[model samples]
Target: MGSSPSTLERHGYTVVRELGQAVLVNSKDGDQCVIKKINLREETGKGSGNTDVCDAVETLLGLSHPHIVKHKTAFADDEYMYIVSEYCSGGDLYQKIKEQSEKREAFSEEQILDWILKICMALKYLHDLNVQHGDLQPKNIFFTEYGMIRLGEFGEFNERARQAGSTKDGALSYISPEILDGKTHDEKSDIWALGCVLYELCMLKSAFSAESTVKLIPKILNGSYPPLPHNISHNLQQLIEETLQTDPGKRPLAGEIIWKPFVLSFLTARSEKSIDELNDNLVKLRALADGLEKVHYGATVGSLTGGVIGAAGGITSIVGLILAPFTLGASLIVTGVGVGVAVAGGATAGISNITNMVNQSTDRKNIRSIILEFQEKMNSVVICLQHITEGMEELKHQISLKNEQQSPSGGTIVKVGTRVSRGLGAVPELVRLLQVANMGKVAAQAARAVRVAEVATGVFSAFFVALDVFFIAMDAKEIHNIRTTKASEADDMKSKLVLQSPEATDSDSGADQEPKSETMKFVKKIRETADELQMSLDELKEIISFIPKLPDIDA
Candidate 1:
């Protein structure tokens, strides 16, 4: 515990105790808190920004899972930080596990199962937000005196941690395979650790017990999970197997597991508990969505606002879009950054349609199937670019029109300033809506591009077949006429000979006609060969045409 008797006078702390690298204190109202101060002056300064602190606070605020700790408030002075969060009077899980071990008992089956399930909910929530809690273990989990579990200390979190190596400091037995193999860590790694914790809770053992980090890494990368007792339920055994899988791709996602009926049937069988967990998760997600909206809006808006102020003698398109004042709601626009909403209007030009776009979120399934998926997206990008160009042109004209109406009073420069302010006041919502449409186009492109190769192959194959058909059609009439004419000529010659040589005998006529019959047969075969060649050509061309004509989606 961190209770500094000396600094307690100034920083408003009556008590402090050093807990590892952190300082814990008792609030004036008797509430417990911890302060993990970062010495910015001594940091590695990866980017030399307060992003580290901002990211930490944002992550803590974003999680709403029951297993995660809730941050109350965080404010910093030049020297140290004061991060207030829910204090678990029951203390950390490690202490509880130790106490239980001393009694020659392990956590009950239900308690372990319940805790693991809660952990899954928390992990699912963080991943949904694209935020990751890199450090997870029994110590990070706290059991409240009120009979609750809370995940804590997620301040140094961000999109970056979602990948791995966010920090060099980490635990061993719970480490992910990627981490063990010198690969970047991601949420899958967290799942691996969750498996480790689950294993310990069940077997009362670590997944890998090693003397040092150096030895632990290799063993984890190739280690086998400790054998489970036969008494463990088949359902639980399967769940453990999925969680401990070495291949990240093969591991089950929280969504994939939580929805299952048999994986942990006992937990779900308790309808009341399951309902509570679901409700708690919903509350957490709503909170995170709110916080993220604010963070993203604030961080991205300053630049856009700055651009508004920097308008000069040249560009008018921006001025036009900025001149119309509009209300930017949070669901549609957070601090000026907006999302898509469903549009009631059928057309793109109306305010209702723009409003709909501002309210929408990116759809995920659109990117899965073919190569045209790629080209189609690219083509959409091109269409967006054209729209943007035209929109910019109209914007310039609007700016010019507004400026022209100003009186000659004051001067030209005054006119410009007024126009600049006026434009800044203009259709912010509209511009944001346009930005969102472009986003749709962007999404469409990404999904389409993902399947570009597949689309191309299919198109190419179809094109070649179409060409073969066309060539066969062109040759059909000519070949048929040639064969018919040749047959008619052979019959006519035989008839004329018969009429002019009425007196000739039957044996001499039959012998003389054999050579002529062979010639007609050869002619008919040649015509048939031509028809066959044409049919093949048509097939080849049909396949050829479709191959290179893949869809082109825009960027």
Candidate 2:
């Protein structure tokens, strides 16, 4: 092994190995530790601020928290500052996410909430101390044994880097829009970065992705990203939306995020109950009751309504845009008018749902009946969801068949009404299901019941987006079909010419073909739609997992 840095060597630390950005060292006391070597020559070369750099490193040694990495000591030589912190054996969050991404697996919603809450708690501690982690990304989020989060690589090192005009440019994907816009870093900016982290944990990819920093700046400023995988909870999705808001003022502070109803309830359930207690559904129910007691019932209903209306409106708007060109300006006008009407109708429906919830809440004695009724409706919704998924799968199969058939003449025309747009038929069914669940939520006492309802609504919302994409995919497939037909005609002519040649053999007849851009585009659409639908189906199946097995009742 290479010799330890002089700063570490003075402390009787030997270099065990070199890590990517730090050194793994063995202390004389027989403990494995990490020594982060920060070069201080650049800052001191200006002939000042050496004392300030030392003071910054010293401050981190005094910081302590359950979720913060434990710093043992800090010392500096003339050229470098070395800080020793406890080594986290379980690796970091970035590695875990990368592994899961490679495996094509996703973290469960409960697991995601657990991780984010721990991170939020750590962040709140830092914020309360008037400290901001200028650099917060998955790589800096370490984990101890049993997967407890220990925030690392924070404090003076980050501050110094920021002062040196190096604010984690490598982690541009996680940088907040405000920072990209040249605003000073603040706690709110940390919230924005955390949102990016949260999105990564859920989707296994950076929320904002681009080929270059120049392309990425506009993306972050615009702050629009593809939706989270459908298997993620709507509440979680909503939380992410709030956190990633481009307007720093709108983002929730770390403390407020910790206290959100979903976070609080989920954390309580995990911390307050043993696996055995959770297995006894009634105990789980009791725990859920206590957790949700702090939740605002009306707000929950309102959020559900908001999600529903937002999804419906987005779908209608997309539909209008898709059909606008066909009608010239008339369809655009109609779409504008239709969207206004839909918004009005959706608002009225939301108010009605809230009113029903209020009326139902007054009758606590009817809780069991209310849950049973909700459960019954959920059964039907589950069947409806399955039917919809199956229909989409069949539609995909039909498209695949169309893609495979090599017609020399014009390709078989898709039936007029056979477009994936017909998937819209499930919208009203889903709406009615939401209304029933809304009524059930008002009267139900258990968080599980509420979660099932939320998941159902989330499935509907995800499906709506899928339906919109499905339309675009169908259009792409139509173009692809026409192009393939023309290409096939040319190929058929070539094959005929080859067959007429005296020297032609089976091998001679085969020619290598170049990739077609339209075919690739269509294939990409197919993959996207399939992936999207599969993810949504996985989310829908989670409802089955959430629904408890009730005792059989006498007829």
lDDT (CA) per prediction: 0.46, 0.54
Model 1, 1-555: lDDT tens digits are 232345444555554566554556776644466655554333335564576666666657555444567676666555434455665656886677777777878677777867777677677777777776677777888865444567765524422222223443445667788876788878877778788888878777677777787777777787576689887766567678877888887676664555332322333233224333433433332332333232222212212222111122111211123211211111222222222222342111222222232223211011011111222222222222222233333333444454565656422433323322232224554333333343344334333433442443454345334323323332333334334544565455444433442112112455335322211222223233334333332332332222111111110
Model 2 lDDT at residue 299: 20
Worst 10 residues of 1 by lDDT: 362-371
Output the TM-score of candidate 1: 0.45
* Model 2 misplacement above 4 A: 1-7, 46-48, 155-169, 274-555
* TM-score, per-candidate, Cα-based: 0.45, 0.48
In model 1, the runs with Cα more than 4 Å from the true position are: 1-12, 155-170, 263-267, 271-555
lDDT of 2 at 27: 86
Clashes of each: 78, 0
What is the TM-score (0 to 1) of candidate 2?
0.48
Q: Best-fitting candidate, measured by lDDT?
A: 2
Error of 1 at 123 (Å): 0.9
